[model samples]
Target chain A: MTRRWFLHPHAQVFLSVLLSAASQVLFKKSAPMSADASPFGFAAMSSGWAWLAALATIGSLLAWLYALRFVPLGVAYNLSGALHVIVPLSCWIFLGEKIVAQRWLGIALVLAGVLVTAQSAAKIEETIEKEIEEKP
Target chain B: MSPFAFALIFASIALQVGGQVFFKLAMNQTHAGRTARYVPALAAGVAAMTLSIMLWIGLMSKFPLSQLYPYEGIERVMIVASAALFLREKMTPRLLLGVALICGGLILVTAS
Candidate 1:
């Protein structure tokens, strides 16, 4: 394995998040046709979308695995909320779909919340590290 | 898609978006029904999926879930702009304003 495999706890989490974002973008780019449109479609049609989705789902599972190593489950789960904002906006923009102004505002609020949460976590980590260093 | 949605839910959201992109491309082709028409798009989707799984595995191995979760907000911002640029979608001024507000709020929150 490479040296990078042994990343700091925080960095690992960051990587996972970055990958998750990438997965979402790619998944959005690769979807198959609708079920309603394909009356005679086999499992392959579903698999096309399912497989791509599986990649993202696997990303989440991996994130969960990494997260368990350092951060509390509650915190990790909370961070996953960011996907709520990212996924929809991506759809609206890339799919040529419409999103109302009010919904946009909601997305902003959620982003704000996430930032606040992250800041709090950083502070907590620092405090914890300092206390540990002071101990004999 | 509900941002709260996780795992399968999130995946479904991505698939829907990806599907639409493919549909649009397929429509533009002379033989829309031909499997060949969708190959590129399908390939792109699969690539995306694979990347996601890899990233998730890496993340699960290292961080506290809480700390990393917030990055999703940043991802959202990226998606909006990317979609507009790549998909030729229109972003209303109000939406842009909303994005700006969110960005500002996120900055403040993180700075604290």
Candidate 2:
């Protein structure tokens, strides 16, 4: 109900966002290098980013698990959609992936959606708090 | 996509959603200080997630990263629905708007 959401509880959600995006990037990097011939690919396993991807994924899930304690799964998951914007941008910056104008427009829309979702969640929280106060 | 591929994708996403719900229940239990109550939920969550990852890997083997990633956006809708149903969270109009915008934007971004 305070800035505590940003500074404390939801910070874990933010970390989930970053780690999830990073893991996706690592997967992207490793994808091309993965051996195409077999299910058991030492080539993919040997890639450092692939391993990092696995770790980042576990880290993201752990952070998400902790975050689900205080935050509504709806709110946390909606904000996690920020990765729609984050992953491609990270790929563009770090992986030199191409960013066409269309993608940029899509990114803006995704950001707008995130803002709206967050604002909506905050409104819900405030309403709940007001109800609790009135009842008590 | 082939029927098998589509089914795999659907199953993978379903498993991911199920895992998320299990994880949420586990955390909620833990929050109430019933630490022992969370173990089965956590184990189930992990199992669902493992299946999801395996199914996803199978799907990705056939599809381009760009083509398949947008399907993940479906999570926003699934999570919102599940939250409303299970957690009794109120579904506001703005939240729906946001979900629409996100899905639209994701479709746009992933379009090649």
- The candidate that achieves the highest TM-score relative to the unseen native structure: 2
Q: lDDT of all predictions, in order shown?
A: 0.47, 0.77
Which stretches in model 1 have alpha-carbon errors above 4 Å?
A: A1-6, A21-52, A127-136, B1-112
Per-residue lDDT over B2-106 for candidate 2, one digit per residue giving the tens place of the 0 to 100 score? 786677788888999998888888988875667799999999999999888766654555565667878888877897899889878677788788888888888
lDDT of 2: 0.77
Q: How high is each candidate's interface RMSD, in Å?
A: 19.3, 3.7
lDDT of 1 by residue, A88-125 (tens): 56656655546566556656676765565565566557
Label model 2 with its docking quality class: acceptable
State the weakest 10-residue window (summed lDDT) of model 2 chain A: A33-42
Error of 1 at A12 (Å): 3.7
Which residue runs does candidate 2 get wrong by more than 4 Å?
A1-7, A33-43, A124-136
